[model samples]
Structures are given as structure tokens and as C-alpha cells.
Target: MNEPSTIEKGGAEFEGVKLLLCENPLPPIDETIEAASDELPRSNHYTEPYSAPLRDLLGDRIGVSTEHIHINAGSELIRFA
Candidate 1:
């Protein structure tokens, strides 16, 4: 069953908040937004299918086959396979 709905609080949240209490300093919001804006044009195309290269890099670091790797599309998609 779901942990009693924190939907009552409203807005975007990381599911990891349930598991990890972090106090790490986040980067400046304006710099982050500017960096994202630099990649805005690429959003016009379907790029999810293009993530294999990233998975390959991750697999190399972890010493696993790329075919065995998976990347969640977003925090909302995080779950056991």
C-alpha cells in the first residue's frame, strides 16, 4: 500500500525524500535554468531513444553489460523491475 498520500502537501517531489534526508547545497537556480535553456532546441525531437550512449558509459563504469542497464525517465518512474 502507498504511504498515506502526501498528495495532501501538493507539488513536485522526489520519492527519494522518503529514504534519504539530504542537506547538500544545490546549485544556483538561475545558472541551472540557463544551462537547461542551452539544450532547449533538442527537446523538439524524441531523444529518449538516444540514451544508449549514456547507458553504455554507465555500464562501463559499473562493469556491466549495457543491455542489462535501465534508466528511469523521471523520478516518478523509479521502481523495481
Candidate 2:
């Protein structure tokens, strides 16, 4: 797992800006495998369940349009336009 502190710092001349912090701990490998067992048959077409709510919250904040948000179940990559 990567550390939160590893997030790339912005420019040197810092301006006051709001920062949101989030931390998610992954389950053990065995647990993850067990949990995903049910989805193995359909994993190829899987998508993350929480993506919509998260996109709704993000809105256009990060240049991401809600309509372009796509999340994959087996991957951490989140694509947006």
C-alpha cells in the first residue's frame, strides 16, 4: 500500500487550498480472493458499485464530467473526460 505522504506536492509557492484526505485499506489476499469468488464468472464485465456516487460528488471539480465517469471492478483506474 502506498503512503498518503507520497502524493506529489504542488508548486513551491503554495497558495491556500482545501485538501481532502481519504484512506482505504485493502483486505488480505486470501480474503479478497474469497470475496471475489462469486464474481469470477462475470468479472470481465464487472464495474465498481460506488463509482456513480463518487462521480456525483466530484461533479466537475477535477475536470471530470459525470457522464464520462467509468469505474472497473477489478482495477483502480477511474476514467473521466
Candidate 3:
């Protein structure tokens, strides 16, 4: 048997689906916009494998070494890890 369409599977037509909790409705602050703009020149480069700067900063704030810190792109990546 063929699989049903999304509307058929859902038993109604869904014009769209929005996960409001997944995003911030407010616009980014000036500092964030400026920082992002500054990084545009280096956007072609791949990010460092370990994100050492971020890890170091977080480790310093929490009184831990970088070895103890782990950062994942998202919950989906963490699930695989």
C-alpha cells in the first residue's frame, strides 16, 4: 500500500506548522548584529573543531577545565553522541 499524504495522515490540511518555542521572537541586539557582521569575512572558513574559545570562557565561568566541557550543535547531535 502507498503511504498517505501529510494532510491525509494528519486527518486535516495543515497550512503550516510553527514551533514558536524553538525560536526567539525578538530581534537580535546591536551587539549581536555587529558581531555576526564582523564574522562574515571568515564565513568561508570551517569553524575550529573544538570551539576552544567558547569552551575556555565557559570553563572559566564555571571553574572547570576545557577537558570537562562538551558542546554540541544541538540536541539532535547530542542524541547521536
Candidate 4:
């Protein structure tokens, strides 16, 4: 009998684009620094699962429902991919 195949899908079947990571070229602004400092106290806690506030803002600007918004941290995206 033939052995079962371990490979699930071939490379040609990949339908997603590859994303690359790079260091930020710009320095943080005063507002960015202030926000980071403010959040430092809550650094130990995990961020909201869906980042509702940011999603809400984006949804309003784009005329889409919050349910259509999907947010992911840069590190999480890289790790998962």
C-alpha cells in the first residue's frame, strides 16, 4: 500500500501575498511618546482582544461596521504568518 502524504498543499496553491518586516524609519513624535508613557502603567495587561476603539474609528471613517474590522499587532502578524 502507498504511504499517506504528509504535505497538505503544494507551493503553487498558496494564494496569499508574503509580508516582510522592517524597522520604522521615523522617530516617535511627542504625542506618540506621551501615549506610550500613559500606557506604561498598563503594560502588564494584555490589550483588548479586538481593539474596539480603534476599530470603531476606522469603521466610521470607512463606512463599515465594526464587525468588518480586523486588527492585529505587527508582531502578532509576523509571528502568525
Candidate 5:
């Protein structure tokens, strides 16, 4: 926990800013981003079973294999066991 620091709300900073611990912005780095508008497979089908390439990349990022990862759609309902 952080000691509540009072913010001056008069001169340059009219809006009082509250510092949070859970979030912090690091300096931006060079990275590749794929846009949805990019041309891709036209096959109107679900990536059945799983998408190996996506899983592979994800696993590599977190230092794990695809077998150790699980995926879920945001729209799909999940039940807590």
C-alpha cells in the first residue's frame, strides 16, 4: 500500500492525479502489429482444434508449449468448477 500523496490542483496540474500500483506505462518499443484488415485466409471456417501458429507464438512468449496452454473466446460462457 502507498501513503496517500496529496496532489496540488491549481497551477500547472488542475486535475489531481492518483498514482496506482497495478498499472504503469513503460517506454514504447519497436513491435509488429497485425491489423484485422490485412489479407488472410478466406476459408469461412473455425480454426478447428486449435491454431498451431498462434499457440506456438504464445507459448514461446511465456516459455511454454502449446500443450500447456488453453484458449477461450470472450463470447463463450465459462463455468467455474
Candidate 6:
């Protein structure tokens, strides 16, 4: 993730909010696979696709339909005002 730009400096408008800035925090492929394995259901040898399971787990937390959720492989390069 990109660092907050000068415009996003903590100020009255952003008070009480927490921000997490990361350059690249993803673990290696093997580690990610191992972590995912632990989350898989033990009773079923086959598992649901990635998006479906994630949506089920995070159903109401984000307040948006799963169709609106997107997965990007790299950093988001665009910015908006």
C-alpha cells in the first residue's frame, strides 16, 4: 500500500481514524498456501472457490455485496480526490 500523501496528513478531518500503510506485506506463496490450508474445512476434501468462501466469512462486515469486492494482484496505481 502507498503511504498517505501530504493531503492525507493527520488533521481535524481525519482525527480518530486509524490508517494502515504497507508497501508490500504479503507472505511468500508457500506460506500463504499453508495458511489457507488451515482455514479449509476438514470434513470436505473439496472447498468452495476463493471468492465464495471469503464472502461467506465477511458477509456483513463490509456492508457491500460480494460482487463489489475486488482482488488485485498488485498495488492500486490510481488515486482519487
CA-lDDT, candidates in order: 0.69, 0.62, 0.72, 0.71, 0.58, 0.55
**Per-prediction TM-score:** 0.38, 0.26, 0.52, 0.47, 0.35, 0.26
Please report the TM-score between candidate 5 and the true structure: 0.35
Query: Which residue pairs show backbone clashes in model 4?
Result: none
Could you tell which candidate, 1 or 5, scores higher by TM-score?
Answer: 1
The positional error of residue 24 in candidate 3, measured at the CA in angstroms, is: 1.3
Best by lDDT: 3
Comparing 1 with 2 on TM-score, the higher-scoring candidate is 1
Q: Which regions of candidate 1 deviate over 4 angstroms?
A: 1-28, 48-50, 60-65, 72-81
lDDT of 4: 0.71
Q: Which ten residues in a row have the lowest lDDT in candidate 3?
A: 1-10
TM-score of 3: 0.52
- Ranking by lDDT, best first? 3, 4, 1, 2, 5, 6
Least well predicted 10-residue stretch by lDDT in candidate 4: 11-20
**Weakest 10 consecutive residues of candidate 2 by summed lDDT:** 2-11
Worst 10 residues of 6 by lDDT: 71-80
Please identify model 4 stretches exceeding 4 Å from their true place: 1-21, 72-81
Clashing pairs in 5: none
Model 6: lDDT equals 0.55
Task: Give the Cα error of residue 79 in candidate 5, in Å.
Answer: 12
